[model samples]
Target: MTEESENTGGLARRTLLRLGAAGGAAAAVAAAQTWAWPLLAQRGLVSPDGAFAAASTVFSDALYIEAFPTSPLILSPFNDPLPVLKALAPVPKTVFSKWPQPPGPGPGQQNSLRNERHQVWTSQVGLPDPIVYKINLLVRTHSFTTSQVLPIDKDGRPAVSFDAKRKTYAAGTKRFLPPSTIYGFNGGFPGARINAEYGRPVLVRFENHLNENPLNLDRQDFGSPDLSFLTHLHNSHTAPESDGNPHYSMVAGPRHRGYRPGMFVDNLYLNRPAGNDDGQKQSFFWFHDHTMDHTGANVYKGMVGLYPIYDPKNGMDMGDETRGLRLPGVRTNNPDGSFDVAYDIPLAFTDFRFDDGVTIHKDFHDGQGEFPAAKNPATHPEWWGKTFYKHFPNHGFVGDICTINGTAFPVLEVKRRKYRFRFLDASVARIYEFKLMTSTRGPKSSASLGYNGEELQGQYRIEDGQQCMQFNEIAVDGGLLPVPIKRDSFELWPAKRREVIVDFTRYQDGTPTTKGDVIYLTNVMKMPNGRKWAASTRFSPDPNYKIPLLKIVIGDTVPDNSLVPTALRARPPLPSNWQSLLDNRLIFEVQRGSAGGELEWLINGKPFDPFHALPSLKNPAGRTPLAQQKKGSFNLWELRNGGGGWVHPVHLHQEEHQVVMRNGKDVTRTPDPGHPDDISGEDTAALDPGESVILYRGFRDFTGPYVGHCHNLSHEDHAMMFAWEITP
Candidate 1:
């Protein structure tokens, strides 16, 4: 067909499509428009889409610990049913499953293992509602000749130091687990729960044992033995040292890094030189290996975990220190007339796929077209996978299945009282919605507090603070963003912590019994986002990624006598005046491009390719002049999207933004959506895309080393990136 004729024909078809869609309701048309989902998984290449990987290769050995607390292991100590094993590479692919429940036993039990390598592990961890984590990190260097090995001590755990000579790793084009790579927390790979309370600190030791050569990953964007690594603490605002600023990276071999915690913070030190600092906030967040080219490899192999900071002054006991009521209604106190509530429950929700016996770390390229590693053979001496010159690219094939708390279809027992639940969307490219069902089959209180879509903008009336100021200059040292959630009640978001009260007094059996209560936290987001999420389908679907997360259970049920609590976490002494300030700002737009390319999630309009660095955020020009905004002032932002794709967990680097306005209105999605789906309040906003939702603001404490990006690990590492610095 002639170019003009083809264009004309395409235009005509699209017009007809629109006309037909218009006949339907706006929402239906919008939904239908996205129904065309691009043709991403088209290429005739071998894609790992609906596949399965080998199970974990169990590796048993009591990691000898010198320190009393056992000082953590390289990966093991994994409990039964989930024996920590080193599964051989290239295992078949398989999706993860969520059994048991999450927030379980904190560490080893937090997440499940589902591989899309064509394989992965699935399990669950049990924890009291809201849990916090402080992750330490180390990045690995790759070597082609030798399998970039992460050595362990006598007992069978990654040792701080290795017994063999740390040879200079041979460099190879960045791909998944290609020998040596730098990543977050403990070397390469991720875990179940990588989130903490709203504001917390995370400390990591990015030990560069191999003294990686930049040429190893990318000749240009490389690190030194001092090859510093910046940690995004994914979604928090923390101290200058803590902010994941590429500018603040330092020597890893024997260095320690520190950071406070809060929200809307930046990761300025992401790839720049270290020894300096960028002011920012710290909130409930995670830390991942944030090096250039190597990020994909490091993160996929697992290098992420929760990082949070906190003050114990305010007390309530779901699992906290103080004591209070059980459910969500009334107000009571200890012998001392003080309101009380339960500790927020944090559920680190992440999905994985395993292939063969290898879990293609999320972010590792699938060797599909586009980012195919250089086949020069000369450039990479130790390159393996000769048949096709394989390399783990900066992304992984979507996996299938879901898991929570380390268990598949896991269950938890909760009280009829009030409880706080915090959720984290740790999936690679999955958009999720939630649904709480009745265990009428069992005896427990139904959910009163429901789900909230605070992230979506342009649905309801908006309550806000201010826009990101280009001006205001308040030196943030190390504080937190505690933007009061202005609602008649509570709300929740992915990676969000909410204090909710579930009263069972009415459904209670009149008895002085002491049996525990059990509740299930089902996932409806999987199906919704599956059909609703926007992806170009640009290339044919990669087998691994398209899978479900997992189901969860709420446990630790209590009796009516000392059950439901009067208050949730005690308010920080009823704010006399609102606090929390924004030192600077960064707005990111996540979306998908045409077919043949992976879906896109960009900051401004750029991706973070170490090879193709993003535009200079530093005084960016060439575009419309950026308006000078107020600093030290609360800012309001209307998070808008391109629409027609899956959703993303947009996390800020320096401040905790309260979802005030959605769809130009003020409506908050309760923690419970309930029967039918009541989104009546003005605070509720469901961003179908192209619409703006205003999220009110508070303030940030310190400003140095921060970032604003997607919480979805894959996007964060692949490209969707930006920085927000509060220059003193």
Candidate 2:
């Protein structure tokens, strides 16, 4: 069969299975595979989808559902300006003295000024008055969409609804589904934004309230089985005690896995740049759960929060467009005491799968005989239409539904003016290549377009000829770029952040956008099962595929003041003798290990051993410790992707690095054509298959154990992580 025919046949089979004819479709596919496999192999046209046809068939038959029943109509309207969380007042000294259950330490004993480990640094740095806030981790319910859908009970019956007005499910006739259970920060999904600034340190007393379950929902099998918690501020240059890494938690703080319920920990974020350098100021960060062996599960369960730090030094002020680079924003102090910056939005992209009311939610842990089979069953049927998760997905988990800012397929109304968007990919393994496109024809159901299963993730698509809008990318995971890059599209890997300035007033072709014009933040990257991208616009474009994740409606014109500057923050210059350190540089390779469950992911052929250091490539005999670095020193570290047809986004904690070499090519002198943004300082390295990157990194300010791991949470949770330390 021709490639076109094969493709058409596969789509038809998938559609049939999606329509509930799975038995017949599977039989036909099984019968044909014996003869068709050879032909497809001979033609070198064996697709990733075809290779995993059985799993795809099972998913389409029972686990698949359209993202939403209705098209754009059901999409939640985006909350204008987003929501800002109010900071809680500091607890009184008398009340703070009895934090632990048995009251271990008094106020003076635990205070940052009095604590021996932090007293010297606090005094030496002349730390200003800290902004003390309290945050809690609790089990709560979250709604992904505003629309109501069918929900099933434990006995496979339509769930009974409890009306708040009537106060009784028996009196209520309307059937309403229960909200998905989530372990959230302060009882909020995506938590609430912490609008922070440089020069002001933040001292957060994080309390664990996960033991409380007022909603009485059956907690799923995912997340830490013990309900312990550890919060990490991603890529922050903080001391080990506040880093929230498992290395420090396991060795120093708790001397166990994580902080237990009813316990609280004081995390002091100095909010200072690395090496006290003005050039190293970072802007965007996120705090989330980082418990060992459960980071992915905890994060997926909604234990995540956003932090956007601003620089108020040297005219680079926050939201005061008149003085600084004027990146689109207007500061507004709310009556509730929370601050908000209009037009400066944080869009966190996450993916999820809802139970189809049939297929059981199962993972490697369920069948591994670790838990009692009958008493602690991993499968749940009463969670119909609620979020479903698999703890140990072989190829890593990629959800079938896409959400931004905790809402699926949301719509945002934008004024015909410039706006600054901080984009974050919070998904487990999915990588997104996003573009702003205007479609002549609006959203249509994916079923009408012959797409099924994961293809129906967005539920709606715009198949008409869509024109792309350009963006001025001004920042990456680290911070502001040295110069802005104009691009029609850019890829965002898991845990990676990209900031862009978009002018809704006009298109790239100089056409003025008018009121009522609709634009879509579309995703064009096609990732079938998270092993890797099936298609990407940067390399191989899929013309027929584009999922509209967010709808942007053009509104009334507004006065413009923000400027996309030609030059932004400058990166620290490398030492003239940087190349001399290459010979002694530590090298680590991330790759697949023995196939099966969590053991598949590995770095340097070993699982995560926080207590021991892994030897560098040059010291294979284990004579030298590569994971230990001296404070106040700089070094070159090479990260290699041991080929397995997979992409790994490697993230290093504490300090951002400057990429000097890519695959032995000098990227410092010349920017990489495929990744021009590599010239910018970044904490995460996006490594394609078989790619190698040499990074110039620094170890400074504070000391103790930290970690470097794959930003793909699943990979990190499994084994693709290593512990490193900075010695005094």
Candidate 3:
């Protein structure tokens, strides 16, 4: 059979298994009764429930098993891989410097110098010496659960081992499952956290060590084929070379691929705020792989890390509750050169699908002949329970399991005081709307609740009758808001950051939260497929559907001094005549193109041309370049959604923007109730269906090619992105 046909067959088999588990014929009848029945019938293999459908037809002979249950309160601070160095012992070299006169211009071209355009400003500010850090990307094993007991199988037996001898474990067998392989930063999951300050710049030498794999694990069919990498500090204001965009990696190239194995690139981050304005100082940022056409796979493999910048100049110290906005935190410097802030936590939400030990590892690349298919789909019995990823998911990929800080279903203990929580949606396509909830019935198993099939994916342990709790939202992806806004829940899209201060001392209703009180961090957004949210708090919110992600237990009260001020940092003023620039605005529309499957995502009816190698889209038969802007120039740009029933979290690299108009409505003059956060400066433009936003942005300080694309990594990797250069 054709690979495409086999793909469909794979989905059908998995669907049948789900149907049987949900009570066989009765469950199918009930599924047909729902409103989604028609859509499900049309798409035979796609799950009506919000779980991933198998993309491979071959099923493993090994028995089906569930994820081993993990204990609560397993959340702990991750260790920094290496100590922070005070000085650069050996001067870092660039790709260009390594090979003076390399090859032809393509992927190997180097545009900027080691320090690039920001060196002058960095020195002029008389900032302290830049901190040097060495980080390596290599393969390692990570455990999702800490359970020692082997998970039970569908036949009431411990899952059979993948060993060639075919040994089976007895019921209630106790043993640790094999860890899944991951390409991590510094050879660890969640990478390393860098606690930085605005005045202290950072220089990171990222060395690619992906070529080494001592474990000899089956390196999956996803990720960059060449094992090359390009690291982009999402939303950071820096030079193009350090920005890690594909435009820089492929330009003026001697080595037209990415920073390959054994090569190192020095990324200099000038922590100074854009335009030297304190209001422009960002709070949280992350760095991850942005290799052309392989971002989703690379990130899914675990190349993600965190960077939280503190504004010490304005009393907004790192964790001192007595100063600045007095947010919740107590700073602790680790002897291992790592840093931690008590009461302040960064939660990265990611999802994943594990190998069932049955389904074959198949994807679009395999079908397209870019990679060879497995000789025997069921041969890799050892892959059971490990993370499974598909390179090209037409509807976009969303995981069946939810993970926080690299651990699945983890719980945190909190002191009965205010705490600062930084939320990041690191999933490939899933968009999460989170709410703090209190449950009277406590946690229950999904099997007991009659949830089966893919529905049982991430909702293994759920809370009963969850009630909402309110919190004070203090910041967003850009930085602090003009003022703190009280919210019961908020939507976090891919690559978007939302900071909230939750006071554990008392509930929203003024009831005191004593020691041992348990609260759950629940996700209310329902996305059956990555196309869009089936139900969201913003539009069609489903009150009954709540999936508890992280558990929180209250402890004894601590000394309270943090204050939620009425006035936070002031935003830079926009020109009164900002509206005048709208007439000459650069308009770009993101929409589905005429192509099928993996090639449909497009910007202005054109796929991204990273090398500027394609013909211009302006020509009748061409589809190349999309945008360009002059350096040091301020202009208005409009991002429009070419309605395809999909929502897009559009991200623009390099600079944050001020939204003036959304859907032709002047939000600057009047607030948008649907999007209250529009008042804050943002780097991402969250566009709902049939929406368009007009932003006032500056292309300043440096000049080079950057990217603006849908933050949905699946959409981005599939070509729903465009390149725009800042001309000098």
* TM-score of every model versus the real structure: 0.46, 0.83, 0.81
Locate the minimum summed-lDDT window of 10 residues in model 2.
Answer: 64-73
RMSD of 3: 9.1
Better by TM-score, candidate 3 or 2: 2
lDDT of 1 by residue, 1-728 (tens): 11232132123222322222232124322332343223222323223221100000000001011110111111111111211112111101121113232222232332122110100011211112221222334444422122132322223233332111222322221222233343334343343232222222122223333333333443211222123344545444334444444423322111222121111111221211011111122223445555532343344444455433222323222234333322222223334212233333445554432111111112112212122343221122222211011122212323232334332233444444443443444444444443233333331111111212211110111121111101111001122212212222122233332322333322223432134433234333322232234322222322212221222233345543344322223112212232231112223355532220133335555554222223322222233212123335454444556554444456554444445434445434332222111121111223443554445543433433344455444455444555444443
Residues 1-728, model 3: lDDT tens digits:
11232132233322332333333434334544464455555667455332112211111111122122211111221111112112113223344236452211233222222223222334656665456667789889888767442443433234443432334444454555467889988876687777877888877778889999988766766677668788888888887777888766666321333677877676778898777778898899988899877899999999988887888886775677888778887776666544577777888888887654545554435533344434432334556557777765656788766888777767787888888988888899898988888888765645446655444545444446465568689889889998999998889989999999998888877889889988888888878667788887877876656787777888888798888778788888889989777666777788864322223477776666665522223322232333677777887878888886888899998899988999989998575887888888888898888999988898877877788888888888767777778887
TM-score of 3: 0.81
lDDT of 2 at 494: 93
Model number with the top lDDT: 2
CA lDDT of 148 in candidate 2? Answer: 45
Candidate 2: segments with Cα more than 4 A from true spot:
1-121, 148-177, 333-338, 367-379, 596-598, 619-624
- Assess the local accuracy of residue 583 in candidate 3 as a C-alpha lDDT between 0 and 100: 62
Which model, 1 or 3, shows the larger lDDT? 3
Residue-level lDDT of model 2, residues 1-728, one tens digit each, is: 12232132123221321222335445435533665566556656366434334423333333222122111123223333333344334444455456542112234332222332442244458767556667889899888777543332322233333322323343113343457889998889897578778887776777889999987776856777768899899878888877889888777766555787876777778888998898889899989899877899899999888988889896595766777888888887655444678888888889887754345444435443223321333333355456777766667888766888788767788899999999989899999998888788777756556666456655667777476589899999889999899988899999999999999989888999999988888888888766789888766888878888888899999898889998999899889999887877888899865332223467877767777666677633344456889999998899999986888999999999999999999899788887888889999999998999999999999888898999888888777888898888
Ranking by lDDT: 2, 3, 1
Candidate 2: lDDT of 601? 67
